[model samples]
Each structure stands twice: as C-alpha cells, then as structure tokens.
Target: MTQRLRQCPRCGTLTPAGECCGAVLQRAKPWRMTKQLVRNLHIFAMSRKGLDAETYRLQLERVGVTTSKDLRRDAYMALMRNLRALPDSPRWKPRGKGRAVA
Candidate 1:
C-alpha cells in the first residue's frame, strides 16, 4: 500500500498519513528466513537426495561453510542449487498435501 503524505494544517509540514509533528515514517522490511529454518531445509533436502555424511561435508566445504548451521541465506541458496544439480544423486521430490511418504 502506498503511504499518502498528509500535510500538517498548522505547520504546513508533510508527513505520512495517520502521523504528524514531523515524525519520520518508514516502511517495514520483510524479514529474512531464520538460520535454524534454513538448516532444517538443507538437511531435509540432503536426506531426500540420498547424500551421505561425507558427501554432505564435501558440499559444505565447497561452499566454505563448515556446518549447515553456520550458512548465511546466500550460501544456503547456493548450496540448494548445487544440491539440485548433482548428476548422480536421486532427485528429491516434494510430497503433495494428502499424499503419504513412500
């Protein structure tokens, strides 16, 4: 939603709607995914992709992250792409709603 600038009647100062007296108003920024959640997603993908412990460690090493818990958002994205591009690993499929795991 676009914030409408409202002019203060007495002071002639413009500010965002619902606020006055020269108070600065800023839009709220969307929060990034939490690191713990990222770790869970990475681990789940690895398990579904049939990656072994050694391979998991090797992949993290390639990304310069010693552990999944230490990975930043960008690194997680890069690692996810790398995981998807693995030639030999079985592709991980997302389970649909109401579908049972095989």
Candidate 2:
C-alpha cells in the first residue's frame, strides 16, 4: 500500500497518514454524523413504505426540510426515531404479515 502524504498549505508541513497536524488546509469529511444517519434512515423508510415523491416530500415538509441535507441534528435524530417506528404507525398499521394502508 502506498502511503499518502498531505502537505499543509498553511505551514508547508507534511502530515503523516492518520495524524492531525493542526493545519487549516486539511480536508474535512463532507458528511456530519447526523447527515449520514439521516440518509440511512431515509432509505429504510423509503423501502418500508415504497413512498412516492409526493408522499416523501410531505414527510420532509413535516420536518421543515425539502432535503435531508437541510436537516438539523435534532430533526435528523427525530426523523430516524419516526422511521424506526414504521411498524407502529397508525396510517399504515400492520396486519397479518404485511402493512395495511388506512
């Protein structure tokens, strides 16, 4: 495996792999924890409901967002909780083995 060396633009110091050099030029991860978690929850919900665009957009509207990228951490967590409760949702109550639409 080839080791990648990162050059710090601010101080010109070469940072070793997997170490922080306290430099501002380092590339940060694009995703926050909530962002990735929300994405996963959204996928789970989609598969659980087979929701169309209109229905999905309505769900997002309840959280005051057009996209998950705009969700706050609290909202992201709350959305995950709600999605995880799909089996208990009144609108789509489970009957026998499959979900029954109300």
Candidate 1 CA-lDDT value: 0.66
Candidates' C-alpha lDDT? 0.66, 0.60
The Cα error of candidate 2 at residue 65, in Å, is: 0.9
Error of 2 at 44 (Å): 0.8
Residue-by-residue lDDT tens digits, candidate 1, 1-102 = 866666665566666665556554443333355767766765565656667778888888887888777777677788888887875335444553544334
Error of 2 at 84 (Å): 2.1
Best by lDDT: 1
Q: Candidate 2 local accuracy as lDDT?
A: 0.60
Off by over 4 Å in 1: 1-39, 87-102
In model 1, the worst 10-residue window by lDDT is 24-33
For model 2, how does the per-residue alpha-carbon lDDT over 1-102 read when each residue is reduced to its tens digit? Answer: 855566665566666544445544554334344655666665566655656568777777777788877777666677666656556333443444665433
Which portions of model 2 miss their true places by more than 4 Å? 1-39, 88-102
Task: Extract clashing residue pairs from model 2.
Answer: none
